[model samples]
Target: MWGDRGRGGYVVHPYRGYGSRREAFLMGRVFRQTALSDRIPRYGVLRDLADVLRRIIRWGLPEVSVEVSLGENVTTVTTDHDGYFDVHLLLEHPLPDDTSWHHAELHVVMPQAEPVHSFAEIYIPPPSADLLVISDIDDTVMYTGVANKLRMLHRLFVKQAHQRMAFPGVAALYQALHAGPSGNAKRPILYVSRGPWSIYEMLEEFFQLNRIPVGPILFLREWGISWRKPWPRRAEDHKYDVILHMLSMRDDLPCVLIGDSGQHDPEVYARIVHEFPERVRAVYIRRIERKPDRERAIDRLRDEIRHTGCDLMLAEDSLAMAEHAFEQRLISERGLEKVRRESSR
Candidate 1:
């Protein structure tokens, strides 16, 4: 099923990988573009509406073969029904130790058609790094009322990236975490969101505009809206699966998870702490909701995780989180001061 313009193409989404001298697991999606106008910027209300309609109408090519190459190693895999591919390869030689991201190439081959080539990048944190950061984008960093559907739609569709407002002091806090304790370690920062793949570019632009540290954006799934299914589907298991995959990637590095109390972060994070008792250094849940019941629930969860040696901070704001991070030795004194200065402004 080709698109409006009778043109068919493929897109290899940005992804992340973790490995050393032996093997690496690389995963990403190859979208079958029915329309070639996916890159057009949508500014006005009509344009944004058109963009959403176009994305909803687009289709994914299934059972297509794809080749991935990095350094001297190459592997072939077929796209699943949803056009997603995960390739695991044994490296001929270990990736360079000096950099965090390594360059790779992807080629999507179709029968009786020319192959499409795209550039891809994979991140590998340096060995000297002290900690890893897993963050949630929606209410945690950006000012999206995720708990309210109508308000979230207004903020997402009406406001452009530059016009969107980030929570105060969040960028500074994230920069501090990216620098680690010594202020030089380039720690990996992975962002996970329940948003669909259609808004991936918009979120990327949002991060760039807000100066938040960028990493692999692991979105849950694409919003598959059809006449047979009008309402968008939610994957409740997405966060647990993604976080577990990231933790398994690097067992040596303890991590700090940051999310907001507006959703299921506290419950999901509590489970992670219980399962990986030794691998979690801290979990920061920003207090976005003021409900007393939410506070009581989180307090009980804190008590449950107290014996695991994982510090759970239900912070009222970014400053509180930064202060606790400094006290726990997760971030440096200078980083804490930066957060304070930024929050004051």
Candidate 2:
């Protein structure tokens, strides 16, 4: 009697996820549609404001049971107080090698509410995958002005996906990395962001609109804030945990970590290198700020972590990063040329 379908309509927002042959994880939310509609309100200042507000001001259908199935695996999970469910799926056998993408079925089950079904596409990297790429979304890939709260908020609320810009040559560089050294490895690129889940759809549209290579997963954070704890927890802590968990899952694989010098990415990525030096092939920090103090700080960090065997590069542009990757044989010559061409245009 008390669901979105009862009053109007409810939706299961299943996020794109990634997995291995043995296990997979998918996260999603259940929300009741607003009085208007689920789609974003169109092109006016007031409409944009309403669009941003509607995303953040969510009414989560909490504590409801959900059924998640992938391949031969099937499980049930209950949404948290915020209506977010993390589906930890265990497969009975390895996923078939014929395909890389798997669509998982999500069924919502709650008392008095009609059972709603949704599909989540999960990417399982093929055996040909040589390396994994984990990247930051905000300042590293796009100009979100994440270092400044006011600018960040303004950009987030006021801009449409087309209005949101990607850093120059990013799409080309990412496509190169996706192609890998031999130019066809089709390596898995997993993006991890410090942003909230509310902005997921916007980010997806931004990637599509920018011609950026879409990652199989966009791991985002959940800020469970309250009046008593208004500040919430440290976001870097969440990032640290997420990276470590991804690293732990595939022991044989090596990954390249990409992030920006802004905020705590330098420190967080350095921590990852220090802990799992063997697992990390390289760490690239995009130079978003030109402050001397920040430059000195990153320089010092680079020197300190040199002994870990993975070099940290402070890239001036996407081309610089692509060049370094080419030299390392992490990307092919054609990939480097692509970035160069894109950067020029």
Over 109-177, each residue of candidate 2 has an lDDT whose tens digit, in order, gives: 767778889899888888878898999988889899987888987786567787888998999999999
Alpha-carbon TM-score of each model against the true structure: 0.90, 0.93
> Which candidate number would show the highest lDDT if scored against the true structure?
2
Clashing pairs in 1: none
User: Candidate 2 at 327: error in angstroms?
Assistant: 0.2
lDDT of 1 by residue, 45-78 (tens): 6656665565556566678888988888898998
lDDT of 2 at 102: 90
lDDT of 2 at 242: 80
Stretches of candidate 1 above 4 Å error?
1-10, 16-21, 34-43, 154-159
The TM-score of predicted model 2 comes to 0.93
As a whole number from 0 to 100, the lDDT of residue 49 in candidate 1 is: 63
